[model samples]
Target: MKHNELKTKNELQEKSLFDKTVGRRSFLQYAGAGAAGIALVAAGCKKDRGYENPVMGGATLDFKDDFGVLNYAYALEQLEAAFYVKVASAPPASFTAAQKAYFQDIQFHEIAHREFFKAALSTAAIGSLEVDFSKIDFTSATSVLSTAMTFEDLGVAAYNGAGPRIKDGGYLLLAGKIVSVEARHAAYIRDLISNGSFADLNSLSAFGSNNAGGLDGALTPDKVLPLAQPFIKTKISAINL
Candidate 1:
């Protein structure tokens, strides 16, 4: 199917799920209005965790409050979406037919996630970000899948770490839903890298838990942005975070 057609199909599926669980209107209501202030108020006492670097010099992420956090997520989604779209557009020759299909499905899902954030944030959302994948060898299965694994792991951590700062229950719920999907993608990619390694120690460690408790790691924005910055050419300013 064509890119636009695939995106539409996936969006319908996401909307259906959203409607069944929590109507889009209701979800937006929760995420809209004073949600940003509430998030700010909730995390007001904490020291700012925004980041900056001389190398980062492009689209800035003006994180005003919880909207800032959401925008951070939006930015990450943009990166992941871009990466998957590129891979799905022309998967590695070494990748099996099933793997190619999986990448396509993941591409749709990431695009849906990216679009959802853009719509939810509306005027508050950041612009689309430019990504640098020059280091990734798209024609090689090991290169592509490894890079995918890295992105998925970082995404899961970014959401987990930012969860506490989200004061609004509605926004929190939104983050929870998206992060779960990210974790699933991480596990799938892990297995693709090495069978039965999905739940292994290294995989669990990605969540920041080195112990048997299997807790997922929550990386603060300062930490996440640096790791993500390498792939993104946009200069993300989280000074207000």
Candidate 2:
């Protein structure tokens, strides 16, 4: 990464909206709702065994190179963009105006991320994946924010784990930029749901020991897919990943 680019990313992180204090109303927006209790449809998904074998059956991430990783990221961006678009179309009745506006901003960011990967991958990009959000309750603020938190956290982990696997520095740089935005989204959503819990032990423990080192979590493709599979209806045949 260029020195200026690095400095810009650092500055963005330093000025992250997650640093703001939450108003009591925003903190208790969904007083009786249990965000943790919202579950995804993981019934038929298989546990990820290894990278060599193709676990998902439909869209082909069949490349044995960095294209495979980029396509994987593209697929995830598709899911997230689709999700935010859905939420923005009809946000929960209880959401404050500011909350709704922030979600719209997030929607734009996810779409831009999705388009960047699609354009970068060009012909190698996998077909747009179908999403299954049947398990999410979009009408409830707690459910929507909880699912958003899940996606942003997963996105950050996916990028962190895949970064070391890319052979090209340019691609790595792109991933770094996108992942930092994702981390910001994760932190903001976490704070919205529960004030000051953005980098708490509970969040860190979910993705292993990033907490011990005071870093964000990372998860290999093998571990990320099965958890993601529930929300993604399109089968991502990730082979040689």
Candidate 3:
């Protein structure tokens, strides 16, 4: 569709500006880490098959290895983005005007995140992912917000857990940047739903121990795929990383 479907797996893996996951704004802001010999991507290295924009898609993505991991993130952002977009487009009957505004901002943030990953993953990016809205219902703002909370917390911990394993400085920098922002977003939303409550910090730390950031708390591609099954229509089998 964009440039004829990525005909080969190698083409899908090739590095070009288009195959990236994060955007320039996110890249510049988050790339504070060492350069690590990686250069920024140029435009249009190779386009994905299903959509004109890399962020838009219709099929399942292949989340294998580091590429898989990035695509996994890309997919999640897609889900979040779509959810918020729906909320913004159609506010629930019970939602207050103030609540609508908050959700709208949340939608914009999630879209930014989705685009960020699309740009960052460029050619190495996965195909457009198919989602199942049935797994989630935004009609009830509380239910919608609660599901969002789960995703935000999961994203933060996943990034923190994956940071050390990244081989490329560029990738790691991107993760830290997005993860930090996600954390801030999470805190803001948590406070929004319930102010002055400890729910702000989702279960990352307990007992004041820093080293307790356990691997089990983090969802690898494999674990996340199954978790996402109910919300997605595609069969994601590439999370071998």
Candidate 4:
């Protein structure tokens, strides 16, 4: 199938699941009317201070409140955006023109997300994180694409897990919007790697035994941070998350 056609189909499937699980009206309600105070309230929460960073020898994630959650997301986005920036700047030798183009788009999206979180968190946002991509072979399509798939899938799951933890409705809505995009990126990358593994049980868990609505694969900060650590040189302490 063509790219647009495939994207449309994937979107329809996601919309169906989202509608069944969390109605569109409900999601809109969560977005709420006030936006100006959302970030202020998020950042004003009490913070845990004085944790050591093992890898880069700096401060660790406070994880005392919602600001910690946003900072956590900021750290992840920084890693992702950096990876994609590298990939887009120097694509693998085996990559096709279309593949390079698609990666570039993903790179732009990630950078946008990173900037958004940075701006939203403002002074509370964590500093730039140092990443270790030593395990990845950027010259090889297999390595690059595999890593991309991992990041996109992990991002989706991370957002899913963090959704309930966000006390601010506006932040939840922001996360929902971003995760939907991440899910689409996951589906697109999965399709590029394998014909139809996007929503496969092997890639994503079912909502429940009934398999009626929504999809599963949410990972809390504790579970997610460890998996992401290998690619990051900065030590993160999500103990309080």
Candidate 5:
């Protein structure tokens, strides 16, 4: 699909006053419109059995509407939940008792976020994704904390970027709530690595005057998908956010 075409269509939809007050039922209806076709395509793919056969091709995300945006968030949440689950299950040997406890908390939060999106999207939600974490050293504290920071930061940016694309006020509000949590997670992880770097100018880019607080970065779907693609085995293409 043409990027400009989809953007124009989304803009037109956003311009409608009716879109702003869309209820849950109407939101699901709009989001689930393309679910059947995508599900059919996904069902045809063979599932992988174990770690050796990690990579498996799957349905690409259809970024045709607001549903697409929600699914995008759902996909990222799935990846994060899976990662944190693994970490919490077997924390790095070098991690302190406090670190282990903090990681467990993060794991639960990510799981909650993942399940919430799944329920919100309902039939429109994508199937379970296959993840590839081969590059991460599970036994290394540095590796684990660094990756957590990356995911949390990316998640905050993703929601910020996608907020305007969500036509339904309810969905946007929910996204805001979730992103705030993600931002907190990012801060915690950052502080774990380097004290007082939670809202550092590097991760949270500064705006306005030098004295002004740093603003978190926002990344459109096109930008976020590439950074996240490596950790996911399933194929995902936004073409254009």
Candidate 6:
């Protein structure tokens, strides 16, 4: 929780726009032409678990050194970017113009985050992973925003939790800088969905705690995998610890 400020409970009501009967054609029309492109299809395809792990398995990521940590951040950025991309693409059935623009800006921000991590990681950056939006079932506004909120909040916690684990101060600094920005993003989205409820204790952080003012649950890599599993195509068997 950001503390000392929050929206009244009565003002925090927002509706979700999901219904099984919704048609893609009408939704596309609502989303506008910029999102109708088929290129997003190359992002993912289903796979059999087989002998090799579907998620690249392991306790660590691939880069091995400082690069590995950077790639880890990069990987997370990819997930966030992909989620926002879809939100901007299909849009909610009853989305307002302002809401739509906010989502679109988030899409750009996620892409920028992804690219920035890649640029910083340099050669250590992993190849782009395929995204399986099929698993998301973004059929309505609630589905889209709630899922995004989860991921965005997860991102904030992940960075915060990972900060202390990092050995290099430079890398730590980068993570610190970026995570603050991510927290801002999280707060904005939360507010968009609910007036002034951005950093409420339930999610924004634990009550009666000093630094626990952002989010209560900070997902470790293991917990994150399952929520993210369906959307990610590449195996993530850990390589670097």
Candidate No. with top TM-score? 1
Cα lDDT of model 4 by residue, 1-241, tens digit? 6545543553454344333212122222322413333222222211311122323574377666677787888888888988987898899999999888778667656655665566566555677777899999999988998999889888988888888888767677778888887888888888888988777645365212112454657888888888899998777776575
| Global fold similarity of model 2 (TM-score) | 0.75
> Candidate 5, which segments miss by more than 4 Å at Cα?
1-56, 204-213
Candidate 3 ranges with C-alpha deviation above 4 Å:
1-65, 198-217
Error of 2 at 115 (Å): 0.4
What is candidate 2's lDDT per residue for 1-241, written digit by digit as tens?
Answer: 6545544553343233123211111111211213221111111111211112222458867536677888889888888988987897799999999898778767656655665565555555677676899999999999999999889888888889888888767677767877877888898999999998877755567776466678887898888888899998777656776
Worst 10 residues of 6 by lDDT: 13-22
lDDT of each: 0.71, 0.69, 0.57, 0.69, 0.70, 0.57
lDDT per residue (tens digit) for residues 1-241 in model 3: 3433532333343334233433333334323422221122212111221234333434444433455566777777776676666767787788888877667666655665666666655676666656677756768777777777767766666666556556656677667777766776677667666886424333444212143442224545555556666776656665234
Return the number of clashes found in candidate 3: 20
**Among all windows of ten consecutive residues in candidate 2, which has the lowest summed lDDT?**
37-46
Query: Per-residue lDDT tens digits of candidate 6, residues 1-241?
Result: 2211211211121001111101212212222324332223112111210112123332247534555666677778887877877777778878899888777766655564565555454443467766666756676887787788877777877776666556667567657766776777778778878999776656454212134543345555555556565767676655444
TM-score of each: 0.75, 0.75, 0.67, 0.73, 0.73, 0.66
The reply for model 2, stretches above 4 Å from the true place, is 1-57
Tens digit per residue, CA lDDT, model 5, 1-241? 4656655554454344124212212222323324343233223211211122233567467766677888888889889988987898899999999898778667656655665565555556678788989999999999999899889888988898888888877668768877887888898999999999876756455211121545677887877888998998888766444
lDDT of model 3 at position 35 = 23
Give the Å error, residue 74, model 4.
0.4
Q: Which candidate wins on lDDT?
A: 1
For residue 79, give model 1's deviation from the true position in Å.
Answer: 0.2
